[model samples]
Target chain A: MAEIITVEHPEDPRLGDYTSLTDVELRRRREPAEGLFIAEGEKVVRRALAAGYRMRSMLLTPKWVEVMRDLIEAADAPVYQVDPALAEAVTGYHVHRGALASMQRKPLPDAAAVLAGAQRVAVMESVNDHTNIGAIFRSAAALGMDAVLLSPDCADPLYRRSVKVSMGAVFSVPYARLDPWPASLETLRQAGFQVLALTPSAQAEPIDRVAPHRMPRAALLLGAEGDGLSHRALAAADRLVRIPMAHDVDSLNVGAAAAVAFYAVAHGRPGE
Target chain B: MAEIITVEHPEDPRLGDYTSLTDVELRRRREPAEGLFIAEGEKVVRRALAAGYRMRSMLLTPKWVEVMRDLIEAADAPVYQVDPALAEAVTGYHVHRGALASMQRKPLPDAAAVLAGAQRVAVMESVNDHTNIGAIFRSAAALGMDAVLLSPDCADPLYRRSVKVSMGAVFSVPYARLDPWPASLETLRQAGFQVLALTPSAQAEPIDRVAPHRMPRAALLLGAEGDGLSHRALAAADRLVRIPMAHDVDSLNVGAAAAVAFYAVAHGRPGE
Candidate 1:
């Protein structure tokens, strides 16, 4: 059972993980360094726990205490009950959605390990926008993509905004970072995966024509929003593919593109 | 020729349409009432004009004036010159993207008119989130979906954030409101459309099975993010369809779903 404690001070040392939740820069540096991530709102907290993430501690207003009573009892960790004002002061925003939990972060799986059993994978390069990262992961998970490979420059999928936007999908989809950048393309290729780069250039074949799902193993390469795949990354791929667009619209945003691409890549996979 | 006037005063009456733009509720009420909608940044402003929207006026910082010099000369509308600081004072946020245009919102075409010529259309019901609205438009336009129809309760497509998020694709796709809720769905049926409602219910047929592209005319019915289509709307649709997601994921956010659905609908259409 959780140890329930009443903490009135906003500056309470034990509540350190929950402070300045809105400061992107601080949290980005602090959370990973501290081996913790903050999951806010009731549904997200519930999803986090369901995904097997252990609660380091939880901060709740009095009203949310009862709402999270079962969670508190199940966690066997500290549950600090603060007034609404104190919760707001500590979090730098209203705790409108109820309790916040600081969950223990698991060590990321190695890139090779993530790639080993994967058939269809998405490899992102410099996709630093957290919401896009989250949105892509949600689509990836939903569409039956096996794993995700992120370049070092990609944003943390565990970021609070990413976690919220993804509806907790960040916890479900297994992902690992690929260091040494474009050279990691060799890692996928060596694993019997045909790596294809997604781009809007006319030189690229239409995605349907590419028929990625037919490949025994395939990995898709995507880039950031405005400047799509870099020259080096594009050069690393076995093939270049484009979504056949109507009219002369330049391109879809990365998030939308990812969903469409994930569906296309997963749609024709063998077996029912 | 365009007339350029330097206005240093933040309270100038002519800048009224551009004031307090960050205020959502006020702008939402005032823009439609005043027969104007705000488009921020150079690309969106250019798109609005290219889409044949008449500009009542434009406010620009010094740096962007030269960039948009050709457009200003062609428009023959009032162009107010303001320093970045004065621009911030009037708009209640830093004008980082260089310009804001007060565009005349053309009278929306009748639902019948938009449906009459469209072969593949997306009809949205109660999709009140502005970003989702914009993202759907972006996907619809890019994927060759000919037009869009919005239910009465759906959010405005030309809202600033929607305009920005769509990257100005909102201007390219033709859309109109379908009033009287589910009853207006008859308009699509009358236009020879096989109206397909997108839902998460297991009873709904897989979207690929629907093969809307094979139909002479088709319109996809989408709903709000979580609650999904209303019973009456679902009952009215010719058939209910769903994207076959995996890993027991319940549903996709409407924006992502729209992209996947739009692609699925537009994929096997006639032509190259």
Candidate 2:
């Protein structure tokens, strides 16, 4: 069972991990360096714990303590019950969902390991938006895509906003950053995966026409919102695919596009 | 030619339509009541005008005056030139986007009218998040879905955040609020449409299994994120369709789900 402590002072040194929560750049640097990431609200906190992530500690308002009693009873970490005002003071935002947990982040799995037996995978390049990262993880997990491979510049999938937006699916969908980016894509190709770059270019074949599931394995590569796939990344892909657009609309946001592309790879051309 | 009028004060009554924009409830009531909606940033403002929405006025920082010279030369509306500080003071947030426009809201087209010649459409129920609304509109437009029909409870697609998020695709896609709830859904059926309710229920047919385009006309019905399709809406649907999620994932965010569903309806089961 966890040890419960009551904290009155907002300046408590033990609460350091939760401080400066809203400072994006600082937290981005400090969290990874400190080997910790935060999960906000009851849902995300519960999910992180359920995913086998070790809890460093938990901070909760009095009301949420009873709400998260099951987790409290099973956890080995210390629990600090603090005033809502103190939580706001420490996190620099209102703790409206009433609970936050700081969890020890696990080392990223080797990309080859995640790809070894995987049939469908998503590869993101320079998708730096945290929300897009979260949304894509959620779709990849739900659509039964086996795993995710990120370019070096993709945002952290375990970031607080990403965890909340993904409803913790980031934990279920295994992912690793591909270090050398375009060249590192060789990892998937060597694993018998057909790497397809998703683009809005007219010259690319429509995604449905590709029927990716017919291949022994497939990886769908996506890029940032405006610039799309880098020229080098596009050249690295085995084939270029597109979701046919209409009405002169520019393109779907990367998150939406990822969902559609994931679904196409998963089930659009069944009976392969 | 647009009249360029310099406004030195944030308190000027001429800026009424642009005030308290970050306040969701107030802007929700005010923008619609005044038969006006706001468009933020350069791309969205340009799309709004191209969609034939009359500009009541344009507010731009001095630097953007030359940037929007063509618009100024073409519009008869007044352009208020304000300092950066005054723009923030009036809108309650940073005006980093540098331009804002108040555009007249056209009367919503009748649901039957939008469905008359449409092959594919999206029906949203209680999807109150402006971001989801915007994302859905964007996907619907790009995926070649003809129009959108919203439950009266759904968020306004023309809301400033929605407009900006959709990249002004909301202006290109025709939409109308379906009054009288599920009863108004009858309007689609009466127009010879197959209404398919999208749910995450395991027993529901996989979305790809239902080739909507093979039908004479089709409407894909979606619900909000957490609590999806109400009992009554499900009962009203001609068929219940699902996306077949894996990994014990609860559900996809409604926005992502809508994109996949729209593509399934638009491009799935070709040559059927």
Each model's TM-score?
A: 0.96, 0.97
lDDT of 2 at A24: 93
lDDT of 2 by residue, A112-212 (tens): 99897899999999998898899899889888999999999999999999988888999888899898979999999899999999999988999888887
Local lDDT at A66 for model 1:
90
| Steric clash pairs (candidate 2) | none
TM-score of chain A, every prediction, order shown: 0.97, 0.98
Calculate DockQ per candidate and list them: 0.56, 0.69
lDDT (10s digit) by residue, model 2, range B1-272: 99999999988999888898899999999989999999999889999999999999999999999999999999999999999999999999989989999999999989988888887889999999998898888888999988999999999999988988888889998898899998999999899889999999877898777767567789999999889999999999999999867857868888889988888888854444
For model 2, the superposed segments whose C-alpha errors exceed 4 Å read A269-272, B269-271
Per-residue lDDT tens digits for candidate 1, residues B163-231, read 888888889999999889889899998999999999988899988777766788889999998899999
RMSD of each: 2.0, 1.6
